[model samples]
Target: MRIVVLGAGESGSGAAVLAKVKGFEVFVSDMSAIKDKYKELLAKYDISWEENQHTKELILNADEVIKSPGIPNTAPIIRELEELGTPIISEIEFAGRYTNATMVCITGSNGKTTTTSLIYHIFQSAGLNVGLAGNIGRSLALQVAEENHDYYVIELSSFQLDNMYNFRANIAVLMNITPDHLDRYDHNMQNYVDAKFRITQNQTPEDAFIFWNDDPIIKRELDKHGIQAHLYPFAAMKEQGAIAYVEDNEVVINEPIAFNMEQEKLALTGTHNLYNSLAAGLSANLAGITKEDIRKALSDFKGVEHRLEKVARVRGIEFINDSKATNVNSCWYALQSMPTKTVLIVGGTDKGNDYTEIADLVREKCRGLVFLGVDNSKLHTFFDSFGLPIVDVKSMKDAVAEAYKMAEKGDTVLLSPCCASFDLFKNYEDRGNQFKEYVRKL
Candidate 1:
């Protein structure tokens, strides 16, 4: 079989290696320059590849193509491939064909990374042979090619889900759906929601689907689709028969095995994280992990970095890097978790964000606002009437400096840009590392 993998980044490079190991003729092509690390991997595997441009002849001749999630269907080359009747699938889809591991896939607009990590921790604590892959750790394809595990906890984004057709999750987790990456969905909320719902696709009755029961959007769409998987609804409030819920300051899980833990015992706090913890607990339970192990893992698991990570406490002021809060809803969660007066660092590449969702939270928690992006006009116009002091900074260093100046000794400085990092940094990780670097310099 001839396999052409597009985008020689983490996912593509890994997929190419897996294909080669599986005895397929493999080629990797990336329009942008391939990172040196991935270039080395391709050569190490003796796989053919091209960078900086897509060779039409080489790519079109493939029997199947594994596409990276970053490349949208709107690309002309992708459109041409569709017209040529070539089958294209995501790396996850291609990798799924080679693994017999029980797939525990998590997807949603927010809290996916946290939930994925938490579930992996729970499985590990239970002494299960598990691999962490997808959007969080090593690429799934690479892990499938190199490691042997009984299960995989994958973090799936909507873009990754779009190209996944036959891959089925033994246990699927859907964190609450919100307006995110609407531009990629053609500015349609339903389109984005539909993409997220694809996580449950191809599942049978034996499979389990865990989701937020309180989200109005999720509830509204549940009636429209007939899902075969067993439903496990989790909520902050107590439900009569919910698989997971908060009751009397404790999170309780009732199905598969009855378990409860003190709410304060959770390593991750905040309303959003409560839901995340519940989803992870339920997934662990469904996987047959003991209740005691789940509780222990939940209490000790450190949270994902760049998602409200506490960087340092300088001069009695706390610095938090929440650069992964790249959407408005994520920023809302970060703001909701702040217990003290906050000097908020926000702004980046806007994705038609509606800031009104966080307006009330901002008014109540924020002492001042610092705009850290290429343009801050939209933020300025929106918050102008609020009568709060707002400052604009052109770089991460200046933003951290300005925020520190505005913050009082008892206040918190948060770098939770409610937008993408493409405007100023390479990615959210880069934006977050720079924030921590600048904050430590103080």
Candidate 2:
């Protein structure tokens, strides 16, 4: 079968390699220049690929297409495929067909990365053969091709979940659904929510579906979507059916064998991280990991990069890099964790963000605001009347410098941007790395 892979980055190249390994004719095309690392990897496999252009003649003849999660469905080629009735699937979906391994899939507007990483650490530390893939480590397709493991812990974005069909998660986790990437979902909250709910699409009664029990959206959606999978709901405090909950300052998992750990001793702290730890704990316990092993892993896990990473203390001022908080709810979590007044660095490609979610937090915790993006008009429109001193800058360097100048000795300079970073940076990692490099100099 002739398989065409679109957007030859990590996802596309991996899918191409996997298709080749499976003895299929695979062609990779990226409209932008492919990275040298991916180019080399593709060449090493003796697979054919093209960069800086997508040849319609080459792509349209595909038996199927594996699309990179970064590419939207509105892309001309994707639209063409839809019109032709040609099946297009995500790299995750294609990879799932070739592996019978247990899939522990995670998705949400926030906390998926940290939760995915924590669960992976638990499983790996418990002496289980596991591969970290999807949105975190290597692409699932590449891992499926080159390695054999009994389980894969995957982090799914709504974009990755969109093209997925027939891919069932042995264990599915929806951290919490908020208004995120609405720009890609026709600026509709329901559309984005529907895309996230796709994580549970193909599950059966034997499969497990984990979620935040307290999320109003999840609660509302649960009433509408009839899920066959066994429900494992978690929350900060115990409710009617929360399988995992906090009690007397102890994190507790009731089912899959009772488990508890001191909440204060958890390596990750903060209200948001409490939920992350709860989800990870439940996932670990369900995998038959010993309670002691789960506890140790949870206590020692350092945390994910760019999601509230500490940069440095400059002249008694703390600089935090939270570039991974790419939505209003994420920034709310970041600000909610602040111990002192903050000079908030926020702004980017507006993803139809409603700043009101973090408005109260901004008023309470932020001493000033740094608008760091190509366009800060939307940020200005909402935050302008908040009466905080606002500074606008296009580059991370200037943004950091201005934020530093505004911050006092005890205040924090937090780069908790609540929108996509495409306007002034490559991606969140690039934005975070730059924030750290510039911060270290101060």
Candidate 3:
């Protein structure tokens, strides 16, 4: 079968390689320039690809198409493919069909990477033959083709979940649903919520569906669309028969067996990470991993880069790189974890962000603000009433130094850009690395 892969980025290139390995006639098309590494991979596999354009005739004639999660449904090429009645599937869906690995997929507006990484660490520490795939580690398709593992832990985004029809996880985790990537969903919260719910679409009674019971969005959706998988709800507040709950400062996971851990002993801090720890711990227990294994993984697992990553402690002023906090909710979580007053370095590509959600947090925790983006009008307008010291910086170094100057001993300089990082840096990782480098130099 002729398979056309759209967007020659990480996901598309990986899909093309897997399709070729499966003896499918694979062709990759990207409107933008393909990266050198991906181009080399396609050439090594003898996969035909077109970079500056998408040949409509060639792509439309394919038996199936694998779309990168980054490509929106509104893209003209995608819409055209849809109009032709062609089957367009995500890389995850394509890879799922080729492997019988038990899939443990996690998705959320925030904390997904941390939770997914934590779960993978737990499974790996337990000596399970597991591969970390999806949005973080390696390409799922690439890993499936090259390194065969018995289990796969995937971090699914709503975008990746959109085109997947038959892809079902044996164990599914929905960390919490929040208003994110709504710009791609026609700015409709329900549309995004529905897309997140797709993670559990094909789950059966034998499958387990774990989610946050405290999030109103997830709770409302759960009430609206009944889940088929055995429900395991994790919560911070009062919960009865909740598969996972915090009581007396201990996380209780009552499942096939019962397990408890002191919440304060978890390496990851904050109420948000506590919930994350609980969700991951519950999954580990359900998967038959020992409580000791879970505890070791939870305590030793360092944390995902760019999310509350400590850079340096220069003269007692703590510098935290939370460049992955791309939304107000993520920034709120970061701020909530701050033990000291913060000189917040925030700003980047605005994704229709609602700063109002974090206004009170900023007012309380932030001593000053360093806006690091091209335009700071929205931030200025929103924060005018707070009368906090606000400055603008065009680069990450300036943002860090400016914040450092403003922060006193025992103050925290947090680079939790509550917006996307495309305005000033290549991406969040680049932004975070730069921040760390500058902090180390201080």
Give the best candidate by TM-score: 2
Model 1 residue 262 CA deviation (Å) reads 2.0
lDDT of 3 by residue, 1-442 (tens): 9999999888899999999999999899998899999999999999999999988888989999999998899999889888989999999999999899899999999999999999999999999999998898888999888889999999999999999999989999999877778789999888999999999988899999999988888877886767789999888865764778888988788886799888778888888898789888988888899989998888888889999998889999999999999888999999988999999998888877888888888999999999999998899889878999999999888988899999999999999988888877888999999999999998
Clashes by residue pair, model 3: none
| Residue 255 of model 1, lDDT score | 90
> What residue pairs clash in candidate 1, if any at all?
none
Candidate 3 Cα outliers beyond 4 Å, as residue runs = none
lDDT of 1 by residue, 169-248 (tens): 99999999988998899999999999999998999999999999988899999867688999999999887557799989
C-alpha positional error of residue 19 in candidate 1 after TM-score superposition, expressed in Å? 1.0
Query: In candidate 2, where is summed lDDT lowest over 10 consecutive residues?
Result: 219-228
Instruction: Please give the lDDT score for candidate 3.
Output: 0.90
Error (Å) of candidate 3 at residue 288 is: 0.9
Clash number for each model: 0, 0, 0
